[model samples]
Target: MTKLGLEAKDLEPTRTIFHSIVSGFSCSPIGRIRLDLFGDSSHFRREPIWFEVVDLSSAYHALLDRPALAKFMAVPHYAYLKIKLPGPKGLITVTDDYRKSIESARDGAKLAESLVVAEERRQLDRIVALAQEASTAPIPAEDPADKTSFKPSKETKKVKLNPEDPSCSKYVVMGSRLDNK
Candidate 1:
């Protein structure tokens, strides 16, 4: 239809500041609300022709299944969707493409996560390999200090630990706690 020849009523979203535009829909109790990103700061010049009246509960599902949520953060954020209204000459469509920003953020986040995960895995693998190598390799020989080479002073070793410390009765304990109270 020649809506251009007719009056052109701008619209704005009452709920969100999305770039969505609607036409030929029923009015609400508050009146028609068309959320236009191109709309002025006052939002007074705009009026709603119709409402999507969506519960929006299914928006997530729709975004995931239809819009391929994996592709981008198509979670019905503000400043999305496009509007093609009846202008004086032709259809005046206003589109705010937020896809680039959304994609940029998403791609950066994914890359960062992947790099972190890969680095964590690499560290874990190195630790595991070191543990395995330690298990397989033979222990280093303790170089015996010749007691004969040292001269005994007037103060002899008189502490005389009989059976040595109780902890020395067995090998060293690893991790958490030890039953040896």
Candidate 2:
């Protein structure tokens, strides 16, 4: 492979190893953990969860079976780290631009809500002003036709639903027939 920078092979064994460990180590907001750890229908949907890089290499070395870690990885895991990022919850990440984006969303929502509220208040103020004018205005002498036209309708209508397919109640599915009613 073509060498870049100081060269990949030139990296110290320990430094290279540390970088590997750091790359694998991850953090996550608790909500993601509860989604995975708790379950699909879990109640703690919005909680923050945190995780840290485990020193598993140390554990393997302490066990005097360093190769076992690889073997352990071979087994199918009923429970395993989600590990990857961005699909709802796997790892925690932070960046200047990402934080700014989150803040921007919150600020934008608040600004929108405030603007809506202010407009609603302005509308209410106008309505109040109109009400005050109407209350103070001289009442017009009532016309006879005005009283008759304001009456509520006393007529009633009946609506009935026809049974769906009298020939086949068992096989006829509900939503397929749009004209049943």
Candidate 3:
């Protein structure tokens, strides 16, 4: 619209909302406009298209949907990366750059990965905040009379390692509950 020297006031108000499968959200269109689209010098189409003005950055300026294709009576061949439509003189065919398409796909993949990482970071931040909150809470002191305290069940006797050297003697504690086998 800016490129064509058109302002927001020029657009016809639209109440329609559309969903993006890739972004997983719904967006209300800014407005609708009947723009003259040219396939070539001979083949041209005038279609009313709804424009969703997003705040976020994108790789592509505009993404045409099935409705736009249907209006032009265009058939897209994905394998050949071409769109064909009936022209007044003959068949109007538009070809896409293979390298540019690959580049765009790569950029889209990167954007998706970055979004996932950002979401994961947000979750981790929430978990950290919860942990910090938990850590700040006061803990009760353990009671000496608690029955859950660990205790050895067997009685033991101590035997000195060196009987001749009493000062250097080290004693080993042996349990009476030992089996002879």
Candidate 4:
């Protein structure tokens, strides 16, 4: 209607903020409405828009039925839900498009998780194969000392041990325990 001029407002989730804007809007005759919406990660964290914690594994049926129940859904980063409201005389039909944010978040998270799992599985398989190869391979044996050509020195003495003598008990021969005769 020849540019009725644009009206802008910032609405918060709380009643105080909503009431300030809504009250003013409701009183005036409704005209064409154009909404420009955007939000950061902090907005989602601050607002209670996202669903509460849910068990992703056991909640399979629930997750399939409700997108908000999916744990992998990304936090809302930004959104735009522009609506062209009808004047007092005009009529317009409105349907929900907010679910798109949650669906996109869930799909993105699922794709990222799948990629990570695939990489982890590939690394695990490589480690398992290496372990198997190590188990089957024979280890090289250490070389034994050569004693075929070795001879005992003449200086080495062998003495018979007397059980009655305490001094003889202290002596050990050839790295073996002495037996008292």
Per-residue lDDT tens digits for candidate 4, residues 22-89, read 12221221222222222322332211232112212220111111343132232322234332223233
> Per-residue lDDT of 45-138 in model 2, one digit per residue for the tens?
2323222222232211111122432322222221241211222443332222444445655765665566568768999999999999999999
Q: What lDDT score is found at residue 54 in candidate 3?
A: 41
Tell me the tens digit of each residue's lDDT in model 1 across 1-181.
0222322243333543223212212223222233322233433223322333322111121121223322222233335555344433444444444665566557656655665687689999999999999999999876566653554444433232334675544443233333335
Q: Write the per-residue lDDT of candidate 3 for residues 124-148, one digit (tens) a residue.
A: 9999999999999898888786586
Which 10 consecutive residues of model 3 have the lowest summed lDDT?
52-61
Reference-based lDDT, each prediction: 0.41, 0.37, 0.70, 0.38
- Separately for all candidates shown, the number of backbone clashes (residues 3 or more apart, or on different chains) is 7, 5, 0, 0
- lDDT-wise, the better of 2 and 4 is 4
Show the colliding residue pairs in model 4.
none
Residue-pair clash count for candidate 3: 0
lDDT order of candidates, top first: 3, 1, 4, 2
Weakest 10 consecutive residues of candidate 4 by summed lDDT: 55-64
How far is 27's C-alpha from truth in model 4 (Å)? 53
By TM-score, the best candidate is: 3
